[model samples]
Target: MPNITDEQLARPFELKHGEQLLMSSPKLETIGSTINHWVHHRGQLTVYMRLNDIAVPSIYGPSADDRNFS
Candidate 1:
């Protein structure tokens, strides 16, 4: 999406999978919201990984998988 042209960014974002009555944000705000939503979900998954004793992958920096992380 970083490759998206300025013209593309000027276009309004559309939702195809949900109720049409839902409000929409601008393209850039929608992109930011989507990224925040993903990070929120990933954090939840990491909690699940901890409960199940599963290794969590690196996100912002080195994770437990890195030999020097601990």
Candidate 2:
């Protein structure tokens, strides 16, 4: 994958999840699925953090644990 590029991400691909299957672009099947799955688990982690009184960091913006952008 050393030569990987946006062109490769645009290629077609297939996916199988449980009883479901899908045909999609490589970018959607790979990057999109990975990010979506990560965010799903991240939400679960936040719940655990709250239960332990641990501050959860913002993923898309400033959080109470972090406010400075600089």
Candidate 3:
């Protein structure tokens, strides 16, 4: 699932409630929700890492402790 592309994100997907459809969205929108959830956890973990004196890895770009971005 890593490195999903824009062409794939434009496609729609659905969730279901048993036999009934629950909801649906483009993959990009779902990604926004997932990223929001991840950011919350990332903030907490970075704080924990700082307190424990562990080097933080680069996420979007270079970090104080690392330069490799993932």
User: Which regions of candidate 2 fall more than 4 Å away from where they truly are?
Assistant: 1-7, 10-27, 64-70
Sort the predicted structures by TM-score, highest score first. Answer: 1, 2, 3
What would the per-residue lDDT of candidate 2 be over residues 1-70, giving only the tens digit for each residue?
A: 3877777778877666875876556774678888899999998998899899998788777766675745
lDDT of each: 0.82, 0.78, 0.87
Worst 10 residues of 1 by lDDT: 16-25
Q: Write the number of the candidate with greater lDDT, choosing between 1 and 2.
A: 1
Candidate 1 lDDT tens digits, 1-70: 4688877776778766566645556798888889999999999999999899888878899998667796
* Predicted structure with the largest TM-score when compared to the true one: 1
Which candidate number has the best lDDT?
A: 3
TM-score (all chains, Cα) for each model:
0.67, 0.52, 0.51
lDDT accuracy of residue 42 in candidate 3: 93
Q: lDDT tens digits, residues 1-70, model 3?
A: 5997889998987888898988899988987988999999999999999999999887677888874444
Task: Name the runs in model 3 displaced over 4 angstroms.
Answer: 1-29, 67-70
Best-to-worst lDDT order: 3, 1, 2
Residue 30's lDDT in candidate 1: 84
